[model samples]
Target: MAKKLELGDPAPQFDLREDGGGTLSLASFAGKKLVLYFYPKDDTSGCTMEAIDFNRLLPQFTRAKTAIVGVSPDSCASHEKFKAKHELGLTLLSDETKKMLEAYGVWIEKSMYGRKYMGVERSTFLIGPDGRIARAWRKVKVPGHAEEALAAAKSL
Candidate 1:
């Protein structure tokens, strides 16, 4: 496993396909703060709630000059369906290759019902305009995560 990233560390670079057919690069957010969240799957309960929460705070994040993007191993098509079904207002990135997940250190072994397997841990990273991570949340809980991230971004 890659070392866990800490605050002030340079955010890992990525170029991935976004939902609804478009590309997004980490460099593209160069002059803007970002709320980069990693979720396990599209259309799942927790993931859906998390996306909705972020969408609900979209205007606040915009006023704070922060862009929100959710990443998952699902394909762009899956993301599109999820976004449409949920009316999500933020961007969603497809990381089928799982390279970005590993680079961010969110892909790891997990257990449920006493069975262990590899999966993406729910995580969120607040990246500053200068590309360094301002804050990171591992094993994130969905309820107020979006608001928490926004608070950190606003402080940055």
Candidate 2:
């Protein structure tokens, strides 16, 4: 069982390697609003749409003082290829061990086409500058989702 984080709860600290190189930690993003999103897999339809949308809105997010990060149980190599193929400018963290996914409660049992499996549930968390969860979206639908999150971040 995973401990689900809630509004006002402190975001879990993570220190993971990024796709291009070097490490990323939640503590390192203390002063900036963080958009931490978890998806089932890379290169999939929904995930790709979500990433592309975010990538397209990267400028707005940056102007709003938010840093976006996508996480999946994929390796650095895979993330690198995905970013290159899509021209993504945001950070993609490799959660190959699922530690951060579990901590954020995005890793869950999912069912599709009458088949069951455990994987990351498409979710996004907006961490305020104070390191607390200001907003959360679970089982997020990709269309217009990134825009919605950006609007919310601007308000914060």
Candidate 3:
């Protein structure tokens, strides 16, 4: 079982490969607000919607000086395809080993259609410029979620 992260806790740092190549580290955004989100898979129904919605709001987030990063267990190649297919402008990180997911407490055992599996629980974390968690949404609903995250980011 994963422990729940609380507000004001230091956001865990990770060095993951970006979809376009090279690596991204949380430390790289030290002086900016960050929206770090975890999803189950790429190109899936809910995941696609969430990505597209976030992509649409990229300008607002950029204006607010907030950096966005989406994470999944998919390979970097898959992430590239997903981004290109949806024309996403936000950074997408690949966590093929699930290390970052586990650190963020978003990796968990889930049930669907009477089957059990370990997967990422759709979740988002807002990190302040100080690297502390400002807000967290677990078991997130896709509709209006991007807007909500943007509002929270703007507050930082």
Residues 1-156, candidate 3: write the lDDT tens digits.
446889999999899999889999999999789999999999999999999999999999999999889999999999999989988897999998888999999999999999999999999999999999999999999999999999999877
Error of model 3, residue 65, in angstroms: 0.5
lDDT of 2 by residue, 41-69 (tens): 78989999999999999999999999999
Regions of model 1 farther than 4 Å from truth: none
How high is the CA lDDT of each candidate model?
Answer: 0.94, 0.93, 0.93
How many residue pairs collide in each prediction?
Answer: 0, 0, 0
Candidate 2 has an lDDT of 0.93
Q: Which candidate is the best by lDDT?
A: 1
Q: Tens digits of per-residue lDDT for model 1 on 1-156?
A: 778999999999999999988799999999899999999999989999999999999999999999999999999999999988998878999999999999999999999999999899999999998999989999999998888998898898
Give candidate 3's whole-model lDDT.
0.93
- Give the TM-scores of the predictions, in the order they appear: 0.98, 0.97, 0.98
What is the lDDT for 74 in model 2?
94
